[model samples]
Target chain A: MAQIRLSSISKSIDGLHTLNNVTIEAAAGESVVILGPSGCGKSTLLNILAGLIPPDEGQVIIDGQDWTNRTGRVSYMQQKDLLLPSRTILDNVSIPLVLKGTNTKKSRTLAQQHMEEFGLLGFENYYPRQLSGGMKQRAALLRTYLFASDILLLDEPFASLDAITARKMQIWLKDFAHKHSCTIIFVTHDIEEALLLANRIYVLSARPARVLKEIALDDSANSTMVKEEILSILDSETGDTYN
Target chain B: MKKFINTAKKSSALFTLGLLLLLWEKGVSWYEIPAYILPAPTQILDGLLKHHQLLIYHTSTTLLEAVAGLSLAVILALIIGFLLHNLRVLYTAVYPLLVFSQTIPLIVLAVLLPLWFGWGVLPKIIIIVLVCFFPIVISFLNGLDLVDPDQINLFRSMGATKWATFKMVKLPTALPAFFSGLRISATYSIMAAVISEWVGAQRGLGYYMTLQQKSFAIDQVLGAVVVICVLSFIMVKIVDLLNFLLMPWNRNQLVR
Candidate 1:
């Protein structure tokens, strides 16, 4: 059974279509990346899957259960860190459990267990304002994980990071996903990011976006060959060469 | 080095105050002004020492009224602010009324309050509540509404309910601004209480000053004025201390 599925999803804003009849599914523990140019509605589709924004017409099923129009089943992290400024790192990471009605002590202990995994153990007492940009993003990712959902939706989570930090995070996320065995649906504009981290990639066309292609990366010879293919497809759709 | 710089700042502030007192003394002596016109600083200090017990009694009454009024205002403002923040229609409906209430002069409020409630603590308390409530509500609503869209979306995607999002994000973020408004309202509370007492009252520092003024006891009046200033400063300092205790993150940003 698919861990997360969006079938015939359609989203419109102010009478203009943003997503049209989009259908996608990720099996349990599978990692899929959605790739597109700006305004391709990749984020919108992710939002619909996460149940943040309801689709005009569609059904979303998670773990063989219909979850359309429901919230809190999928853990979602946005591009910005969105760490609560007043909360300490530990408190921010523990927010998901707190919202789920866990006792404070239990939630803290649970969050503390994952702090070392994210390299945030020592900075537990630090406020968000005291953290570096990379640390803040890591803390945010930890928050999403602590919610303990079976599926994760990440919308350009590393888009704001410097290139070096983004590369490091990509490696860390891949390792983290493997260890946790959670399905991940990631949205990104960078073909390189999709190539490096995704098991499969879905290319989306511009506004009123529809899926143009779905490339299986597991069969590719190596990362470089996958990158080239994705770049070519993006170039053809955009009509602009990417070096 | 940081400690030395802080000490130097304190010394400079004291020095400026000393200069102002010296000028005040010299002006009074050179002009040979009558004691009734303006008492010298030393004469006012002497009056303060002589009438200390009486001043304390009056001050306690004013402080009680101010504290009670300000406390009630804080509670009302928080409830109203949270409601208006969550409901857009209520905000649009009542926001202009709040602004309009503030434009009505305080003196008019003082006079009207006594007529409605009779000359008592109730009238003075009402005046202070009127003066302090608007700013607290306005600042709190502004802060609560300032919850970032990105943050809201992030929580929404996590399947958080609207109440959960408010509790975890909006409330904590709005606290700094709420405390700021409280601090401002604290000072206003003291001033409003005293001024209302001046319009009509059997007790309070304002009433004491009015009695001294009628008797041409200029030094005593000056002493009462000084006490009022000190009370206001102390309330503001207390609010600052409360802010430090509640929001320690802001303390590091405060310049020495």
Candidate 2:
């Protein structure tokens, strides 16, 4: 597992500053959550980390090496499951391996081995349309896992699900991350979700987003106190905009 | 309930056509209308059976031209549509010209094509290609452009190369729209072929119909119209079947 360090990342699109000197870090095997209001450039930060888009200024270091604007180093799961609707669940999960030049048969066999672990064992032959939302997200997660097991960047992966299903998936992911001992950087606007799943939470301001605060959690930490403090930080930032 | 409604809708269409045909047949006989103006259904049927061999020859000629032109158009549209999509500068330069090309009446081309290329199958085919290629290329380009942005980003984050992303995500995603265009183009293909034949051709349903018209054989002309309708219907059905085979995932939506 590789630790990730995103240092002073800044990005401007079409003269609109989206991110402002945003620095975030996660140790190996740690689960970090970036919590912010909607449209606060949280996804843009994740895109920078995933190397899908280059930040105007940043150094993305993983395992002590600079990986700036370099792709294929981290696995990314988008908000939508984005399973290829044309392929069966088995084939969808096997796509990353196939794209990496693994033979189709070999990739499918590898995917099948992990089906039971993802709670998608019986739905291998089912198309994406046949599966429920929760199952689709699970299959997507398995695909991300297959892409690279060391580091994961997830952008609101459970945001589209119903509340009950979303909680269930969060629980499943928390356990999965702990068991696998992989670095996970999750982005979401849901504060409760951030509190529930993250070992440490980074609260962000609104547009031209900057990290407002980083809260580390333990058994002794008061979640409500942490939540309230995060609220105030966000509230103060919101106040600054109006002023 | 939806399925029942769909079946009812289809049956209603059939019933309406049958009723109209029955009224036409009865009214022609009841009013003692001259066959030269409008032939009765039975008279048309009689003429179809009498000239079956001749009709078959002309039908085959039209069918061959339509199918050949359509196949050529499909191949060229896909190749050119893909090129335009991949190259932004080329698309910007050429796409407006494609739209501009559609404004010029194909009938004008039909007259001049034989003069330019000679009165052979080549001119008729060129007219069919001109008529059918635009819908396919434009629709396919729309599909390619409208692919989910997140899906492309997801593939990119997975280290998928441009070709890989195109094959796995873009191509399949664009198919339903492609088929929609193909269906439209398929319907037009036969009509275009026949029109070219009408302009000038030695053998085709269009030529046969013109011959019947000159001799005041309205029943035989009606027979050719029936063959044209049947052939056009068959072309659309073939496109539908291709869509079904190529896009199994879209089958459920098709049924709906």
lDDT of each: 0.86, 0.91
Q: How do the residues B1-256 of candidate 2 rate in per-residue lDDT, one tens digit apiece?
A: 9999989887997999889999999999999999999999989999999999999999999999999999999999999989999999999999999999999988899999999998889999999998889999999999999789999988888889999999999989888888899999999998998899999999999899899999999999999999999999999999999998999887888873
Among all windows of 10 consecutive residues in model 2 chain B, the one with the lowest summed lDDT is B247-256
Point to the candidate with the largest lDDT.
2
Tens digits of per-residue lDDT, candidate 1, B1-256, equal 9999989888998889999999999999999998899888999999999999999999999999999999999999999998998889998999989899878888988988889899989999888888889888999988898899878977876667888889888988888888889889998988898899999999998899889999999999889889888888898888888878877666697544
- Interface RMSD for each candidate model? 1.6, 0.9
Residue B187, model 2: Cα distance from true site in angstroms: 1.2
TM-score between candidate 2 and the true structure: 0.96
Q: In model 1, what is the error at residue A85, expressed in angstroms?
A: 1.6
Over A193-229, each residue of candidate 2 has an lDDT whose tens digit, in order, gives: 9998899999888889998899998878899998888
DockQ, candidate 1, vs. native dimer: 0.72
